[model samples]
Target: MSEVKLVAIFAENKTGQLAAITQALAQAGVNIRWVAIASSEAFGVVKVLVNEPDPACEVLRAKGFMFSLLEVLAIAVEDQPGGLDAVVKTLARNKINLRNASGFVAHGRAVLLIEVESAAKARRILAKKQLHILTQEEVMEF
Candidate 1:
């Protein structure tokens, strides 16, 4: 799988927090590709994959939003049973520990963004199996 940039925004779980974040990004014209929100009572963590992560980061930074950039692998898998199994098994066999992951289906494909111990090794292993790894541009296509 190839590496993609993910932006993490830490904000209060109260109202207007996400509004301000999205508004700033929208004002800067950052096209958000995919977004996931994880929350408890106090705070929420918003992870986003955008068309241009670097520009998004700069825009949010200037807006005074608390955020960070993360390197995540975008892997395109089959939209059928055993599809995820094949990918995860490959990484597991290679001694790569999966720390966190998120997935979504679009264009009839199951796209998974994974955080692992060794992205390079995971890419090599998937490459040998002829799996498709998404680039930044490709991710936007979805």
Candidate 2:
């Protein structure tokens, strides 16, 4: 499947909050593949892709952290400028509104991870355009 699970941990904007989260995950032996932190004045969302999401979620629960599992598309883009724009344009043309998006380069591949209103439909549209979508195992390999 092209859908990959992302762990979105909601945290307060305080010192050492990130460290605590990572520490807990490390203690639980969860390998984080990618992570992004976005914050406002008082709160933040820590999004992460991990090697083992189910166990990671359990660890977060045991640690009293509030988080959710989000299914997102991992699209393979060109590892160059405009690579992301190209995918965005295609989605825009199809009237697919992206809820969230981020990118990373790993294993010599440029990946665009995105959350949309309808993942299945979006996948179909992107597939028609010849965009490569990463499978679950493929994403973990990175």
Candidate 3:
């Protein structure tokens, strides 16, 4: 899989938190490509893979939002039954443990952003299986 720099945004896990973040990004002209949220009562983390990571980061920083960057793998799979299973099974066979994963389907393809024990090794294994690993440029195109 290709390497990607994903943004981890920390915010309050209450009403209007997401809206405020979205509005700030909108005003900054940044577009969110894919997003996932992990939350509890006190706070929340919004993991966003945006079209322009730099601008998104800048906007968030300007607004005094606490955030961090993550290096992850982006995998492209067929949008069909068992497609995800095929990719995951390969990792399992190699004993690669997944930390977390999130995906979205558009343009008839499913893109899975994964954090695993070793992304490089995972990429090698997936390549041998003929699975498609999405490059950062490829993701921006989507």
Number of the predicted model whose lDDT against the real structure is largest: 2
Candidate 1 lDDT for residue 21: 89
Index of the highest-TM-score prediction: 2
The global C-alpha lDDT for each of the candidates, from Candidate 1 onward, is: 0.86, 0.91, 0.87
Task: Show where candidate 2 strays beyond 4 Å.
Answer: none
User: What shift in Å separates residue 59 of candidate 3 from its native position after superposition?
Assistant: 1.2
**Per-residue C-alpha lDDT of model 3 across residues 1-142, encoded as one tens digit per residue:** 3468889989897889899899988998988888888888899898888888888889999999999988888888889999899988989899999989888888998888898878789988898999888887898876
Q: Candidate 2, residues 1-142: lDDT per residue as tens digits?
A: 5469999999999999999999999999999999999899999999999988889999999999999998999999988878998899999999999999988897677989999999999999999989989987888887
Candidate ordering by lDDT (highest first): 2, 3, 1
lDDT-wise, the better of 2 and 3 is 2
- Estimate the Cα RMSD of every predicted model relative to the unseen true structure: 2.0, 1.5, 1.8
Estimate the lDDT of model 3.
Answer: 0.87
TM-score of 3: 0.90
- Winner on TM-score (1 vs 2): 2
TM-score of 2: 0.92
